[model samples]
Target: MTTVAYQGEPASNSSTVARTLYPAGSELPFTSFEQALDAVTLGAADVAVIPVDNSAAGRVADVHHLLPESGLFIVAEYFLPIRFDLMAVSGASLDRLECVRSHVHALGQCRKVLREGGWRTLVSDDTAGAAREVAELGDPRHAALAPPAAAELFGLRVLRSAVEDDPDNTTRFVVLSRAAVPAPHTGEPTMTSLFFCVRNIPSALYKALGGFASSAVNLTKIESYQVGAGLNASRFYAEIEGHPEEPRVELALQELRFFSTEVRVLGVYPAHGHRRTERSG
Candidate 1:
């Protein structure tokens, strides 16, 4: 069976997504995303389920940084809706808060409520971990911003419910495997991740993207970062729909092959947004 590695403790959203993404696989938990990638590299896990981005939280640059060099392929994508809850001890009230703790994104999601009382702010590695920490700390003054499911798991009280800025907040995660698979559906249409460095100059980016536009390949996302390749060198990453060789997609890739200094397609996989309720793993 495939063993899926995810960062954070059991019951973390990442783990939840892992089980959803690879139901028949075993689930492995890691303390960090780096460690999860390491587990897959070391063959401790057959794959990794990692959070790449959130609609409200925006880009997760670290995931992008790690992806290109990980030597693993994103075999599938899963979009999980995020619901942040304010958790405190059984008898704690909003008026009793001395501080609030959570990952930066979670804290930011509830910034208004957290800032209202001038409570001290704290950061943790993950939202569930913070909720668990608050439970272990036992201070009524300390609360955690996490999911209500996590609060229940940790025996904490849901002091407030669904406080995220966006009701439609969604997190997109990738299922990493040793080898690429025929776009996930396990069986439909999905996105493929690609990483490349464009030759630096005017229209370099425009020209690189021209293929997608010309072929009607449905380019989904594009991001750029400095590769630190000396004076003013930068690279870009892109995600596109369908495989690189499907008629129009093939033609587009051929066009980009010459213009890009370095080009690599990360993987072809099923859309994560389509698997919101998966529970196989």
Candidate 2:
């Protein structure tokens, strides 16, 4: 059986994605993202399911910094609709709850409920961990904001369901493996993720990105981050909506490489169906 690694307790969003992707696989949870990625790198696990960003919370993990340094390649992407529940041990009453606990992101995502309740907040390492803590505390005064599955996992009762501030909140997760598995260029929707550093010269970034404009390539996302504590250079992580093997994409990359000091293709995979669904909606 396959062993899937993720950075959360069972029933956390990452765990849910891993289970959905590999139902028969065994799950291995780690305390941190780096540990989960390391498991895949050291052959302890086949792959790691990691959250990259959330529509409500912005970035969940520092993937831009972590991915480049981990030497892992993205194999696939999954979009999960986020849902948080207010849960506590059996016999806990919503009216009696005085404090809320969850991962920082979960607390942030459920701001509407938190604001209405006006409860004190405590940040835990992960949502499931918060649920487990609530269960262990056995206090009706302390409730947790956690995934629905987490309520069942830790035997906590759901006092409120789907408490996220935004009904359409979603998180984007990436599957990482130690080796590259670029999807075949079969003309379907595809996403190419890459990292590049432009040479430190006047208009270097502008020139580096001009190729995409000239080639009519659609860049879905681009974000620049400082590297090595150096103000003179910056690294960019970009996602473009085409396979690198395509002619126009190839031409754009050729131009990009000419102006860049370094360039690395992180992954080229089939775009998630959610991308189309989201756009059409």
Candidate 3:
């Protein structure tokens, strides 16, 4: 069976997406995104499934840098709606709880719930790990904030379902493979993600982006991230709609060459649809 490497405990959203894509693959868990990429690069796993963004955490930079350098290519995509639940040992009550345990992200998402309930919260490294701790401890006063699936997996009972601060939370996942796969939706509206460095000059970015404007193409997203250590250089990652061969898209990239230090087209894939927010926890 092919092995899929994911960065998180078994019940994490990343692992959930991986299993959805490669139902028959052996799942490998890594403590970090870098390690998951290592598994794919060293042939320990056939592919790595990772989250790139969450409605809550914004962007996951780990996947951005690690993927570019690993020589692996993103071959597929998945969007998982996020949900968090307040879980405790079976038959436990919320009023009896002392402190709640959860990942930092989860803690933030469940802030109001904990604060209003007069429960102290402890940040743990993983959501399911925290739930497992609560299950093993079997303390009536102990509770964890995790996904409903995690509560079920760890045999904890859900004290209250869908406790996240935002009901619209969703995370986008990318599946990478050693072998490059052609852009998935040649005929469908697609999104292309790429990074480029612009020369430090007035109007440099404006000149580079003007081609898209002249062609009536929309630049959907743009963000700058730092590269290099102490004497830092910055690079920009952008997402645009359309194929590379489209005249406007071609000219935009060509224009970028005159102003950019480097340009890399990371992936071109079907655009993600509007996140199903009401489904979030």
TM-score, per-candidate, Cα-based: 0.90, 0.98, 0.89
In TM-score terms, candidate 2 sits at 0.98
**In what order do the candidates fall by TM-score, top score first?**
2, 1, 3
Candidate lDDT scores, in order, read 0.80, 0.93, 0.79
- State, as a TM-score between 0 and 1, how close model 3 is to the true structure: 0.89
Q: Number of clashes in model 1?
A: 6
* 21-124 per-residue lDDT for model 3 (tens digits): 88888999987788888899999999898888777878764665676678887666678888988999977997889989988877876777988889888887
lDDT, model 2: 0.93
Which model scores highest in lDDT? 2
Residue 40 in candidate 3, Cα distance off native in Å: 1.2
Worst 10 residues of 1 by lDDT: 272-281
Superposed model 2: Cα runs more than 4 Å off = none
Residues 1-281, model 1: lDDT tens digits: 88888887766788788777677878888778899998998899988888888888787537668888888887777778888888888889999899999888887777777767688989998888998899999999999988777887989888888888788788888778777775633335657788888776787877878988998887778877775666664676788876765778878887787788888888887665444344232
Once fitted onto the true fold, the runs of candidate 3 whose alpha carbons sit more than 4 angstroms away are 229-233, 275-281
**What's the C-alpha lDDT at position 259 in model 3?**
84
